[model samples]
Target: MKKLEIACFTIASIKIALENGANRIELCNQMEVGGTTPSHEMVTEAAKYDLLKYAMIRPRGGNFVYSTEEFESMKKSLLDLKEQAIDGFVFGLLTEDFQVDISKNKELIQLAHPLPCTFHRAFDQVIEVKQALEDCITCGFQNILTSGLKQTAIEGKEILQALIQQANNRITIMPGGGIRSSNIEELDRFVQANWYHSAAITDGSNTANAEEIQNLKQKLHA
Candidate 1:
């Protein structure tokens, strides 16, 4: 069966995602900053849910580019979380020129050690797509969550198709960004991935809205 993972920004939303049948959760602390590494408290708390949880390892918001200290801090964060009995971790790193920072990312991945690693949307910023894919494969990344260089996966379906074809089982390509129940059908029919990710939020501002969460799950299962 197809699998659906939900990107959750807070503890409340993580609970909502789990209650609604999301098979996995990508835990992040700050959604407004795109996403950042979650706290140890949050990670430990999430592990209790019995659902697959992957923590984001971004040190700060801004762009994927990082200073030397910031990159070192990310590695340290991974080392700290490696002791946690969690599923995996997600993050990405790039050079100031928008090229893949292979060395820095490799160091962070090593810090993650046994945990599976996912190269996040930072892959989108690389100037060369095919080269970046090959680099990710070479770096031992398990998956790549991208939108095929488009603002949204739907808008980039053709490129996504090509990317998936090129992947050829080398690594999983999980499309994210702008995914919702309204467009999931078309995505499911077109992408045909083993997994997909969506952020299900409510109409209101704060707190996880129970009704909207349930509605999203229903659509996913449908």
Candidate 2:
């Protein structure tokens, strides 16, 4: 069956996701600028829950490129979160020229070790989608959260489908960005990805809507 992974920005969001039967959650903070790493305290609290959780490892919100200090921060975050009950890690890195920073990404993926890693939306900004997908696979990422380089999954459904076909099950191409119950069926009808991601915030709030999360999961099951 298809799985729904909610982008949870707060502890409340995590609760809502769990209560509503979400398959998994991408836990992070500062949803306004995409997402950054959640605090150690937040991860500690979230770890108490009985759901699959993937912690975001981004240090900031501006771009995929990072300075040496920022990269070090990511490494630190990953190491610290690994001590928690996190099921996996989500992150990505790119060169100034928008190519995948394979070396840096591989380093973090290695640190993540037995736990899988999902290369986040930074995949959208790469200059070459096909090459970047291969790079993420080479870097040991188990999944890639992306919108097929488009603003939203629906708008990019065609490319998303092509990606899935190209991936051929070597890696999971999770379609995220602007995914919601209202449009999930349409997007899935075409893209047919194994996983779908969304914040499930219908009220413009950082917290997820329980009903929205349920609806998204229900639609995926349907």
Q: Which numbered prediction scores highest in TM-score against the true structure?
A: 2
Candidate 1 per-residue C-alpha lDDT over 17-115 given as tens digits, one digit per residue, 9 for 90 to 100: 788778788888877777888877788778779899888899887789888798788888887777776788899988888877888888777777778
Q: Which lDDT values do the candidates have, in the order given?
A: 0.80, 0.92
For residues 1-222, write the lDDT of model 2, one tens digit per residue. 999899999888988999998899999999989999997777887888899999999988999999999999889989988988999999999999999999999999999999999999999999889998899889999999999899998888898999999899999999999998999999999998999999999998899999999899889988
Off by over 4 Å in 2: none
* Candidate 1, residue 204: lDDT: 39
Per-residue error (Å), model 2, residue 53: 0.7
TM-score computed on alpha carbons, candidate 2: 0.98
C-alpha TM-scores of all predictions: 0.92, 0.98
Q: Name the Cα RMSD for model 1.
A: 1.8
Q: Residue 202 in candidate 1 has what lDDT? A: 51
Q: Give the distance in Å from residue 124's predicted Cα in candidate 1 to where it truly belongs.
A: 1.8
